[model samples]
Target: MNEFKKTNIENPVVVIGGGASGMIAAWRAASLGVPTLLIEKNKKLGIKILISGGGKCNITHDGNIEDLLKSFQKNEALFLKPSVYKFNNRSILKLLEERGVETYTRDDGKIFPKSNDASDVIAALEWYLRNAGVEIRTDCSVQEIIFENNCVTGVKLNNEIIYSSNVILATGGVSYPQTGTTGDGFRFIEKTGHTIVPLRPALAPIKLSNKFPYGWGGVAIRDAELICLVNNRKTHSERGDFLFTHEGISGPTVLELSKYAAMELANNKVELILDTQPDKDATMLDSEIQQLIGLHPNKQIGNIAGLFLPNRLVNHFLNSINIDPEKECRKLIKEERKQLVKLIKEMFIGTIDTIDITKGEVSAGGISLKEVDPKTMQSRLVKGLYFCGEVLDIAGRIGGYNLQAAYSTGFTAGESAAINYKSQSTTP
Candidate 1:
């Protein structure tokens, strides 16, 4: 056995996984004078944190608790209210600042380290954990949770068992399995008699059945509105920048609605409706086209359309609608103009084929929140068991909401676990 694994303390708070929530939980517990041990399967800690936001690491979002709560889904917002209120963005930023990691918020409210280095954030957390006297064991994987009579006793490894009075499961969701979040936490929680919500990919790129044309892969539509339709009924819509990929669509707008698209795809035909000219309705756009035709009767129709869209997209639209690019604007018939206007106003992009969970920014499901106390992050089913971070059924949208949730839930779980352990130890 390794030196770290051989060293064990009695009644220590054992934290499983060493991601965002796990590190914070261990830090909080140890900071409160409780013996805490954090175990990670990976060789190093915070792999996900190091790779988040293209390695810049969006640490958290900037806003009040109410605005932050509004960024999540209704059920998630309701469940996350207490944790977020306790460890708001300001509190997290302050904590990081105290450890020499300064942060800045973008105009869109996404916060990143002022140094633009994810390593800085990870280093700060690791520093806190070490300075707080939290024992961290890397390359150690927990195989099972030892529970008896509705209480967690310890975690079982391949060759040994580490006993603890309290165990906090901070393993992240099954997204980006390369980072070691291979759904191991779900198995442990399920074995411990906790409900596991069906896991799915969220904030992932949408793969379309119809691939974009050869050169259209890198083309981006600024200020476009993406609408999701199920069974020909409009279900969800979002407006933002969207990028065309060889396989499908991606960007803020597509990623935000990808979860709903994935859920609706299993039973219904899901189609993406892209409004290229989101600023103008069909009638208004047709009128504008008419005025353009009046002013430049001899100009090519494609040229006029290019003013409203990218040249490549304009050519694609003209070809899809069976219009000749060489045709003069004056020669354009009312029906052809209507078709062009319709294409501009509402273009059916393609059907979503699948959402690859590996490409997902965060997994959408995990331990059911009903089995957890949101205020304390303690398991309602098992004593001495706590759940936090992506392991729980809470996932926030892009722009640092998920990281904030991890920190908040981890904070609550760590504090509560420590206090519970202290009280148990002091009791007669």
Candidate 2:
């Protein structure tokens, strides 16, 4: 255990929220020799962390800094560059490993605890906070941020005011309400004079308007590309595994493009074009179909289609193109073969019905980045005030990107706040 420096500061550096960012922020602040207090509205800390990556807890991604930065949008990447470079994936994993939490990275670059238990991740974070001499308050909701003349004084919990010159708001976004994230941080920041970007669902599943009328639920398509088109023009596209759900289409590819699909669906004709065999063009697929027909002249057309498509889809695909699946391959017409090739190349799934933010993996908007200093995560308008984690307008693609952002920003905010507090205490 490292020794904390003795200080005479009256008020401690208070960190609100007990999720990924808040825990790291509190631990970083307290470890820096400044007294720190962490507040959580939930019954316990790290509720969200416990449920991250379906309870396995994706700690971060495995890659160099530049490659990871490219995973996010240009502006968000630029803002995150400093903090991410400072703390980074290797840094967090090293911290976890030090706390006895062994981790491994997936082939896709997602890093998770070797124990495969999210509880261990939470235990490690909690242990860090405790050993760093940080006081933690759970089941306490901060009602307001107490500020005077555009400077944060502290936070108000219930009727009591907790005074602190430095406050870090790591309250997260409105996604996963059951996990305790419900946009509470937004209200707190807005009251203190900050512009909030309108919230939207990012990394959300796409609900189809037709609602899976084809009875294709539970069907999985591999190596497929989903293209989102509005007004017959391509808007966005993603390539990955796609799944048919009871109400809509989901899986990695759909979630990646759902944000754009939701935005385009608001005021246009939105359609999803699925390329099942992206590697094959119309001519190439048609040539393959001809070769199959010649090889098995006596085989049923449906049986021939099964050679290229899933058995479950053979009948439906052939029927949709006005082809008799029962007909022998030798009797198949050229036009019918072309139709099959066309559908195989570019198949229309359905229009998007809804993309609910509540069901999203992350909310895309929060306190506008313009008013927050990316370098330190401190509010430019409010001294002694800082924001980090999902509360800021930064969302990344699926994988371990979001968690890394939380940790990186949290570290920056905590270190900056602690150093600022120390500087203020020593000034004559």
Score every model by TM-score: 0.95, 0.93
Model 1 error, position 79 (Å):
1.5
- Which RMSD values do the candidates have, in order? 2.4, 4.7
User: Which ten residues in a row are the worst by lDDT in model 2?
Assistant: 1-10
lDDT scores of the candidates, listed in order:
0.90, 0.88
TM-score of predicted structure 1: 0.95
Residue-level lDDT tens digits of model 1 in 158-269: 7777988799999899989999999988888666678888888899988887877778887888889999999899999888988887766788999988888888888888
Best candidate per TM-score, number?
1
Residue-level lDDT for 311 in candidate 1: 81
Q: Model 2: per-residue lDDT, tens digit, 129-165?
A: 9999999999999888878999998787775678898
What are the clashing pairs of model 2?
none
Question: Candidate 2 at 188: error in angstroms?
Answer: 1.2
Model 2 TM-score, all chains together: 0.93
- True lDDT of residue 35, candidate 1: 92
